[model samples]
Each structure stands twice: as C-alpha cells, then as structure tokens.
Target: MTAPVAKLLLKVFTYRQLAVGGGFLAGFGYVYCGIGFALSALPGYIILEDHFQDQFPKALSASSLFNFIGIAVLPPLLQYLKTLFGSREAFILFGAVTWHMIPAGFGLRDAVPRGGCIDRPSVSKRHAKTKRDLKFVNKYLSFCSCLFYHKNYAILVVTEFLSSLIYISWALFLVSLGTSAGLREESAVILSTAAGVGSFLGTALAIGLFHFQKMNAYTSCAVPLLVNGIGLVGLTFARDFNSLLSLTLLTGFCLGVNISGMIGIIPSLVCRYHFQQAVVINYFIDGIAYQFGGLISGAIRDLYGSTLYVYGFAALLSFVALPWILIWACNKDPNRECEPDLS
Candidate 1:
C-alpha cells in the first residue's frame, strides 16, 4: 500500500518538489517498515521452524550475517551514490531501483501449509463485508489482548524492548562517541565498520556454538546480554580509538548473538501457530522502544555532555534485566513440547 504510493510520488515528483515528496515518503516509510518487519521475520521463521527445525539457530545466525552485510554496506553505498549524482538524482535513482521490489514480491510463495501459522481462505462477499464493519473496533482491541495471553511471550516482548532500546541507542551514538573519544570522523566511521565486521563474526560464532557445542537457547540468549553489558562498561573507560573500536566490536558481537538468539528461540518458546503473532508483537514493541531509546539517549547526551553516562546507564539496565532472564530460563517448563531441539 505505502510502497506503491511512495513509488508513485517519487516517480511523478521533480527535484523542485523534493521536500513535498520527502514528506510523503517519510509519512509512508513507517508503515512500510512495520509491514516489512512482519513479512520478513514471521514467514521466514515459520518456514525455518517447519523445515529446518533442529538447525533453527544456525539458520537464524546465517540470515543475520547476511542482513548485517547489507546494513554494513548500505550507508557507504548511499553516500557514494550521493557523491556520484547529486542528492536529488541519487534519491530518484534509489527510488527507481527500489521499485523493482514490487515485481520481485511476486516470486514469494506461501511456505506454510494451509491452516498453518496463518490461515486466510476466500470468504463470501457478505461475510467479508461484515468483517470490514467490525474491523475498525476489533483490530486494535484484539492486538492489545494478545500481549497478555502468554507469560513467556510477554517476557520475551519485554526483553526485546529493552534490548532494542539499548542496542539502537548505542548504534545511533557510536560514531559520536568515537569522535568524543578523540578519533577523527573517518576513524569513527572505521570503528563502525569494525562493529559490522564484529557482528558478522559473532553470528558465525553463534552458528558454530549452537551447532557443534550444543548450547541451549537460554544460555544463548542470556550470555549475549551479559556480554553486551560488560562491553558497555568497558566502553565507559575507552579513551583511544583502539580501545573504543575493541569495545564497539565486543558490543556488536553480543548484539549479533542476542538478535539471533531472540529470533531462533521463538519456535522453542511457542507453538507453531502462535509463532508469527508472537514475533509481530515483539517487533512492534521493539520498534517503539528503538525510537524512544534514540530520543532518550540523545537527551541524556545533551544533558550530561558525555556518551559515557549513556553507556553506563544502558549497562546498568542490562545488568538489571539479566537476573530475570536467568530466572526464567531456570524455571522453564521441561515438559513443554514446542520444539524438541531447544537444548
């Protein structure tokens, strides 16, 4: 919906109306992001759960590795494009290339079986009309109700929110923090690149640990949180580029592990049919948390005039959350039968 509309606006508008076009693009971008999150994560996890059930963690790690590569490349690639062409032309070119996704979307197939995670069948016209009438009232209410139905899922949602808050805050401030620590802008950017490399390495390491070492889901999740907390503390004392880069790498590695564990463990925590809903809810909260986290971190940086304080605050929060995760893992129901390979 938003994608096509954004594409159309980009195609029709000229550089003179760039501001108007950008406004339309920003307005629709959030919707597109939300939709993309659901589509990419839910279906991919469902398909992996259905087929590669035993190797879900490895699969998730591999997927995250690829995603990290893209994230690491996109910024520099866009900058290069902006340099080669002016900002207006670069944006136009980007929009034109991205429009290819519409055609590419046609290749997607429903990997889930009929009556699986999501079931939608053709209904009678009358029934469809009736649903439309009630949708306005029921839609948000039902979504809100889902948040409280499952205790484990609710815990995961909280964990995701906090984790996203910390992770995004750190990511958004990493370069600034590096510069504050006496590095040049180019060096700070290089540190960010090092973080990306660390993320790739972390995912690869998680894959190995999950596959060969037989690390359980709980340990996989909790260890990364602990590692990240420690890394954040380390960052508070990092005074030079080398030290900052090392701390950034450590944080990035733990971030990769945490992300993979979160996605990989979902199938183990809930039944197949509920997996998609759980992920959708978790990511929705995560998105909100990320936005607020950035804002809050910015505020903290402004108030304190120090990224160290922000890092310390995030570390403190991480440590505070650690015990709950440990307790949850300790109390996990042994008889639960969502996924046999969770161990």
Candidate 2:
C-alpha cells in the first residue's frame, strides 16, 4: 500500500527531499509490510497447523520458490524498464502495476480454524486497573518487554539479528567484491542471478527433504547457517569470476534454507496467539538490522579500502549466531504441540 504512494511521491520531490521522503517512506513501508505479513501469515499458519501440521515445513519451502523467482527476475526486469522509460516514469509504471495488490488482497479468504482456543478476553476489562495505575506509553513498553522475556523468543531475536546483519552486509558488498576481483558489471549481475537460481534450488531441496526424509528444523536451520558462514569466508579468498559466482550461489542456497526453516519452525515455537506478535517483532528487528548492516559495511569498506575484511567480519558474525540457535534447538521439545487458535 505505501509502496505506490512512495513511488508517486518520488516523482514530485526534488533529489534532496526525495532522499528524506524516501527514507521515511521506506521505513514506514517496512513497518506496514511487517504488520501486513504477520496478519496474512497468521491465518495460513493456523490452517497449516490444524490440517497439515506434519507437512508444514515442506509447504513453507514450496511457498518460498516464488520469492526466489522474484529475486532472480525483478532486478533485470526493473533495469530494462528504467532504460526504456526513464527512472521516474518507470517507477510510476511499476507503482501502477503494484496497485493490483489492493484488489488481490481483497480476494483472500478467511482461514481461521474451526475449533481453537484464543485468550482474547476483553482488553479494556482486563487492563482497566492497570491502565489506571500506568500511562499508555508505560503499558506499551511493558507489553513489548514481556515479548523478549520468553527464552525461545529471546534466542530467536538474537539469532535473527545476527543473521540479518551478516546477510545484508554481504548482499550490499557482493557486487563491489566482484568488481574488485576484475569481473565485468554484467558478470556480477549474472553472479547475482546465479545466486537466485541456487536459492530456488535450495528451497526445492528443503521441500523434498521435508516431505521425503523428514528433516528436522534444527538441521534445516543450523546447516544453512554453517554453510553461509563458510561461503562468506570463501568469498574473502575468491579472486576470479567463477570462484565468486560459485560462492555467491552457495551463500544464496544457504540463505534460502535459513529463511524457509526459520519461518517453517515458528509454529513449533509459540502459541497461535503469540505468533503474530513474534513474527512482527522479528520483522521489525530484521529491518533495523538490514539498515545497520548496510551502514556498517559501507563504513568498513570506505575505511579499509577492501571488501575482504568486511566479508571476514560478516562471516564471524554468522558464526556467532550458531551457539544461540543450537542452545534453543537443544532445549526445544521436538514433539511439543501448539495451542491452535483463530485469533
């Protein structure tokens, strides 16, 4: 929703104003998108939890295929459009097409499970005394703080923060790394495309494993993180186009597995009522981490005049996330059942 508005505004604002306005709009869009995703994912997760609980991981992996496809295609598509139509006009055209999501959103059906327990006792009634005792801001702060008190949620927050930090840093510097290695711009783009293809293949493989081999969430998550770390380390040493491209593909594949596994395992982590909040918080943190990652990586790149150190630092961060995830996974009950809810 905010995407189209941002695009339209981009045409009106001067370059300076556009930067400020674009930043605000991008932040707002990230928050809104996080909320929207949580709302949308909740119902689908509920249905999956209720009916297809055993195959939920596979289903999620299958769903991620489209995301990989978009990643693989959208950059070249957008560049072509920009070349053909000019920047502002291209954005306007893309915005016009993006507006179709409004109608598409309306077409979605309710997916609440028939029988489920949700602790939605009236907030007004339940919090009346507390409201009298505390200010609205205080109440809000308290609620947010409680989310992090949960052991699993805490671990998730830490792991996700680290993962996003490293991943975004790598992504922002990838093309620069390629150029530094003497690869042509076209070849760098091809390398990114190959990574996307690898992502698609990784998601497909995860789905196959989930369905046929009954792969566990821990394996799905841990293996990818390890692979991603290794790939990042490999990138620091890669000097040629083929070596860089191969490492990027490996990194992308690991990323795909990590994303699918993280999302797929959410149902196993929290009750349905808390799931939306958890996911929204995770997305919020992820957005912040992405911003910071780019800034930090850019700063380091400028300071050092080399990408090798940046890659090495990101790899170190990736490795740092391993223990948190492993501890959480070790404590998690594999056969634990979630409380189903429609809320």
Candidate 3:
C-alpha cells in the first residue's frame, strides 16, 4: 500500500524548485520505503522458515542472490538513464520501476504453521479489559524478555546489532570512500557494483557449501565476519581503483555469506513460536543500528575529513563481535541450547 505512495513522493518533489525542501521530501519518501521493506521482508523470512523447512537455506541463498543482482544492476542502470535522459527523468523512471513491488507483494500468502497453530489460554471478561489496556506495553516487555531466553540467542542478537552497525556504516559510504581515494565518479560507481557482483557470487558459493560441505552456520557467519574485518582494515592501504575494488569485492563477498548464515541460523536459535518475534527483533535492531551507524560515520567524516576512519571504526566494531561468535560456536550441545527452560 505504501509502496506507490512512497514512489509517487519521490517522483513529485525529489528535486524540483523546492531545493532543500525537496531533499527533505525525498528523505521522507525513503523512510516510507524503508518501513515498507522491513514490513515485507520480515514476513517473507518467516514464511520461508515455515514453508521451506530443510530447504530454507537454499531458498534464502536464492533470495540473497537476486537481491544482490538488483544491487549490482541498479546503479549502472540508473547511471545509464542519467547519461541519456536528465537526472530528473532518471529518478522519475526509477520511481515508476519501484511501483512493480506493489503487485509483486500481492502474491505473498500468509505462512501456515508446519504443525498447525498452538492454542493459547483465553482470558475471561474480568481480566480481558485490564489486559487489553496494557497489551502493547506487556507485549513489548514479553518480546524483550524472549531475546535473552537462551544464551546463544542473546549472543546472536548482540552480534547482529554490531554487524549491522559496522556493515551499514561502510556500505553507505563506499562510493564516497572511492571518490576520496581519487577515483572518478563513474569508476567509483563501478567499484560499488563490483561489491554487488561479489555478493552474488558469494551467495552462490554459500549455497554450494551448504549442500556439499554441510557447513556450520555459526562458523560460516563468524569466519566471513572475521575475514571482512581484516579485509576492511587492509582497505586503508589501498591507493588505486583496482586495489579499492578488490578489497570491496572481498568485503562484499564476506557480507553475503555472513548474512545468509545469519538468517539461516535464526531457526536453529529459537523455537517455532518465537520465529516471527526473532525476525522482528533482529530487523528492529538493524534499523536502530543503521541510524546510529550513519550518524557515527558522518560525524567522523565531518570532523576528520576522511572516510578511511569510517571504515576503520567499522572494522573495529566487526572485530568486537568475533569473540562472541567464537563463544557461541564453541558452546556444547548447541541444538539443545535453544530449548526454553520449563522448570
């Protein structure tokens, strides 16, 4: 529902005579788009978990592959449009393209539980009125409590938050970072697209590893994060376009494997009843981390006049999560670790 409105907003007021005001309107439109994406994606993951069962990893990998394909394609496509048509026309065309998601979204069906729904105790009229009044607050508290119900889950949440914070900060600034290193705008864009291509390839690799090697989810996620962090730190030494492109490709590949593992790990980390909650909470953390990441990275860039430090900070945070990942992986009887305490 909000998809067309969000696109229409971009089409109407993105860069007209409104100037700065138009920028604000575009920002507002992006907020709507973000909300729509979160709403759609969270449910989609839950649906995949419920329906795909053992095949969820492949399903998710395919989804990630397509996602990066768009990431790989869109920038160059937009650049081509801007080259031929004017900038305004490019944005307008882009907005028109986004409207397709509305129809695509219509095809999604609600997930049916593999074993059917579990019944919960019903409240009587006397207690219902009071419970209804505090429902929102109570639900919020319940969700928070569930986050730490198991040690592995708690670790996953923290790791996810840090990962989101680190990755989002650098990912958003990749183009600017390339430009800062003396690459032309077109070259920088190509550099960004290389990351997407790398991600697509990496996800494909993960799918193969999942089937053939029977890779451990924790190891898959943790190892890539470790590699990506080292790669980002090494990125500071990159001087030429090729060097920067190579490092970005490596980091993007790690990012794809790490994310595929992260999403696939959720089912193993929590019970079926909490799957939706886990997805919601994970994305909620992502949204919060994204806002903080932008502010932190921008502040460092503004204060120091360098994007290198931004990647440096991201690298630092990425390393900080490694210990927790190691701890989670080393823990004994991992499958039994997710079971809720009933005594």
Candidate 4:
C-alpha cells in the first residue's frame, strides 16, 4: 500500500532540485517500501512454503526470478527515462510502476480457509488477551520470544543480521564503486545490470541444485555466502570493466543462492504455528540492519575516500558469519530430525 506512495514522495522531494534533508526523506520513503515489502512477502513466502513444501526452493526461486529480471532491466530503462523526461518525471513513472502491486495484492487468496467443518477459532480469537494476561512493554514480545525457543533460530537470525548488514551496502554502493574506479556513468549502470543478470543465473542454478542436489540448509547457505565474500574482495582489485563485470556476476550469483537459502530454511528452524512470526521478525531486523549498514558504509567511504575498503569490510563480515553457520551445523542433533515448536 505504501510502496507507490514512497515513490511519489521521492518524486516530490526530488523535484527541480533536491530539497533540504532530501536524503533523510528518501530514507524515510524507503522505510515504508520495506514495510510494504514485509507485508506482501510474508504471505507469499508462507503460501509457497505451506502449499508446496516439497518444491519450496524451486517455487521460491521461480517467484524471485522476475525480481532479478527487474533489477537487471530497470536501471537502463530508468536511466533512459531520466534522460528523456526528467528526474521528477522518471520518479513519477516509476511510482506508477509500483502501483501495479496493488492489483497483484488482490490476487492473493487464501490457500485454505481456516474454518469449513472443523470450526477453528479465528487467529485473533485464538490469541486474544485478557486484562489478566501478562504484558510486556510492547506487542512484539511474543514474536521476539520465538527467537530464543530454538538455538538454530537464534543462530540463524544472528547470521542473517550480520550477512544482511553487509549485503545491503553491497547492493546500494555497487554503482558508486564502479564510478569510483573510473567507469562512466552508463558503464556503471551496465555493471549493475550485469550483477542482476548474474543473480538471475544464480537463482536458476539454485532451482536446479534444489531439484537435483541433496545439500542441507546449512551447507546451502554457508557455501554461497563464503563465496560471496570472496567475490566482494575480488571487486577491490577489478580495475577494468570486464574484470568488474565478471566479479559482479559471481558476487550476485552467490547472493542469489544465499538469499534463497536464508528464507527457505525458516520452515526447518521453526514450526508451522510460529512461521509467520519468524518471518516478520527476520525482516524487521533486516530493515534496521540495512539502514545501519548503509550509514556505516557511507561513513567508511567518507573516511577512507574509497569504496574498496567498504567492499573489504563487507567481505570480512561474510567471513565472520561463516563460522556461526558451521558451528551450528556441526552441533546439530543427529538423532532428532526437527525441533518441536513452542506450545
């Protein structure tokens, strides 16, 4: 709902020239976009996981395919719009593009109604609170409590937080890094397109691997992330277009795999009842980490006068997250197949 509004806000704040504190306003708009994403994505992910459990990975990959395609295609198209129209008009057009999501939202019908013959209580009714019920400082205590119910979930969130902190910076700064390395603005845009193509290929690869390969969740996530870190570090040494393009493809491919694995594994970490809570909590933390990462990256660029250091720092974080995933995989119970959800 707020997605199109964010774009409209961007259009307004950026008209003629950037208004004072435009950067802050732009960030605020992105926050709404993030919330909008959470609202839509949570249901889509839940629906896919619940209905297509056997082929969830491929289904998720298929769903994400168009996202990568948009990433690959939008930059060049938007640049053309900026050249033909103006920044303000380009934003207006993009805001119109975002409006399509409203109709898409209408198509999301329930996979199975809760009460037909079983006479189940409504979700709100089931969880209804009384004045006597224990309360916390906020309404999110129940969701937050789910994090500690399983050690795997706790580790997953930490790994996710650390990885996301670095990943968001990579996506936001990739173009800046390209321009800093003496590429033209158009070439930098192409570099972003290359990354998107790489991500698309990576998603295709993941779909194949999930269909044919028998890798566990930990291996699926850790390997791609570790490679992703190396790819980021490789970017520091890429002085030419071809070098940067190749490395960006590798990095994006790894990112695609890592992202798919990250979300797909939630079903394994938490039980069916708490799945929605887990998803909400994961993305909420992600929203915060993304903003924090951007600020940190911006500061590093300001201090060192180079995006190379920013890329290196992001790589270091990937390395840091690798160990946690490995430790969790090693200590995972051999006898028990899955953890029981909190009742």
Give all TM-scores, in the order shown.
0.74, 0.74, 0.81, 0.81
Evaluate candidate 2 by giving its C-alpha RMSD to the native, one decimal.
Answer: 7.3
Whole-model lDDT values for every prediction: 0.70, 0.71, 0.77, 0.76
lDDT of 4 by residue, 75-123 (tens): 9899899999999999889878987778888887666533233233553
Clashes of each: 0, 0, 0, 0
For candidate 3, what is the TM-score? 0.81
lDDT of 1: 0.70
* Residue 274, candidate 4: C-alpha displacement in angstroms: 1.6
Quote model 2's TM-score: 0.74
Order the candidates by lDDT, highest first.
Answer: 3, 4, 2, 1
CA deviation > 4 Å runs, candidate 3: 1-26, 116-140, 333-343
Which residue pairs come into collision in candidate 3?
Answer: none
| Between candidates 2 and 4, the lDDT winner | 4
lDDT of residue 7 for candidate 3: 68
Candidate 4: the clashing residue pairs are: none
Better of 2 and 3 by TM-score: 3
lDDT of 3 by residue, 127-184 (tens): 3553465466456667554454446777788888888887787688888888888988
- Quote the RMSD, in angstroms, for model 1: 9.5
